[model samples]
Target: MERSHVPVLPAEIVEFLKPDTTNAGPVVDCTLGEGGHSALLLEHAPDSRLIGVDADATMIERARYFLGPRASQVEFVCAWYDDFWLSYTGARPHRVLFDLGISTFHLAGSGRGFTFREDEPLDMRLSDSVMSAAELLSGISQEDLADIIYVFGEERYSRRIAAAIVRARSSGSLRTTGDLVETVASAVPAAYRRGRISPATRTFQALRIAVNAELERLRMALPRALAALSPDRGRMAVITFHSLEDRLVKWAFRAAAGDEAAVGRSAVTAKHSTASKFAPKLIDTVAMPEGERITVLTRRPVVPSHEEVAGNPASRSAKLRVVEKTRIEESW
Candidate 1:
């Protein structure tokens, strides 16, 4: 059975967007996923024509089916959000949305090894991703693999896990999801294996993120989304599930809003370059001074209510942040 997805902070997202007023203009859902968020957003935005973009073709088809009649209002594009937004030539959108979480569809239905409970192939690439987890594991050194798990996953037993992976791969026994999971389980302590979270969770996450270059695309997408916002007080809402993503959104919003503290701090790291193997490009690019033409709507990131989190465990780590465009430079 295909597990249904629930949009996190659905009510809050609609309220922040004020879709009724903005519905006369174009709206964009940069990460359409299974179209759960877009469906809700469009419910309140009757007149809004939508540009829904997603990297996975399967997701585009699933969203198309799930949307049903609402599909008429949306222009579904099977492309990465960054690519779609950067080259977008249509009318600027008044309301934009980005949900940074991976889709429940991928975890529950896609047989590409997104879930550890399955014994599928370790091919964790979305449509636009360059490499597969299997390919990455087969060639990566133990040291590099450890750094990826540590930096991207924040896994404390990353070194041990990487060592185990290296050993299994060398013996040609690390090709399947089960093999990787077993390797990770053997590396972590008994206590860690019995913790609230699965021991292999971080390893899988890190591998998926690295394979997809998720952070790199997000860094490029934010500025483009800001620029594509209509000059007439366009608003954008982004929902992030991890600290790495939230930090990027926060930094972009702060820099775009001209927050004094952000400006001062950004000066030193504005030109920071990635070192190719920097754990899936750990640092996000700071929005430059000229991009300072927006107002941060959410003073702080919004978390899911206890009730919501209880009902939908996936919402537990979600955080929402919104911003409105003050103006757009002609250069944009």
Candidate 2:
């Protein structure tokens, strides 16, 4: 089936980021992709302007074209999300979105190795400035490779796959998407190879994550995003495509919402400190320091509906989490 230019959970996003009709301000779309979400935001919130950011220059142009006449309402920035957010000097945004998934155009047209279905160069970089996946694989140690695959991809056979990759690269054979796919297929059991998904899916995902330093970028961007919100009622939404990204969003949001458990080990130290004899004075001195800045709108991540998935299977794994800034004074 031909896919529509539908951003996952479009309705949910528009609703979650519903601007005050009287004074809707700018929205920052940190992962502009094809600009589907930004276009929709412009359509839904007439008063809202969009600051669209993307790492890929090609994708930024594509988004500009996709947005067309509505492009007037957007300011496109070809840069990584963290760089754009950290350096932004404009007015605070009332809405922000980070859809952390590769666009359809990226998979189907990028000629980059985002998909194992096609034979492309092993250059799964989001931008030309970053190292290519092939270069990364060739230089990475098997231990580091396995750690990346297991941690980012959550694939159990990471060790075997990493070993196979090292073997293939040592023989100067692992240079393209096809080579990596073949390596992974041979590394896993035949029964596993016959599964519904491609055997190399996890490996590709891991390489892309590592090449882009995607997780680290997200960790740095989230707090900046929270701080960029218009005080009192700004809303931010992040749509993650996999478990690892989702976990980062979940924990970050929980921490912003001031959940003690979300602080994990740090919470214990604070707890013990508060129990000491001088605790009252300490707490009183910094009474407002630890107040929550955000209220998580969705207790559980909002996933694509079955009907939406039926229409666009690429969105099947998309999970959207949203939060609203509580006040201007509650900066992270």
Per-model CA lDDT versus the true structure: 0.81, 0.79
Per-residue lDDT for 294 in model 1? 83
My TM-score estimates for the predictions, one after another, are 0.90, 0.88
For model 1, name the residue pairs that clash. Answer: none
TM-score of 1: 0.90
Give candidate 2 regions above 4 Å deviation.
1-5, 264-292, 328-332
For model 1, how does the per-residue alpha-carbon lDDT over 111-171 read when each residue is reduced to its tens digit?
Answer: 9898898999998888845778888887888888987887668788888999999988888
Best-performing candidate as measured by TM-score: 1
Most lDDT-accurate candidate: 1
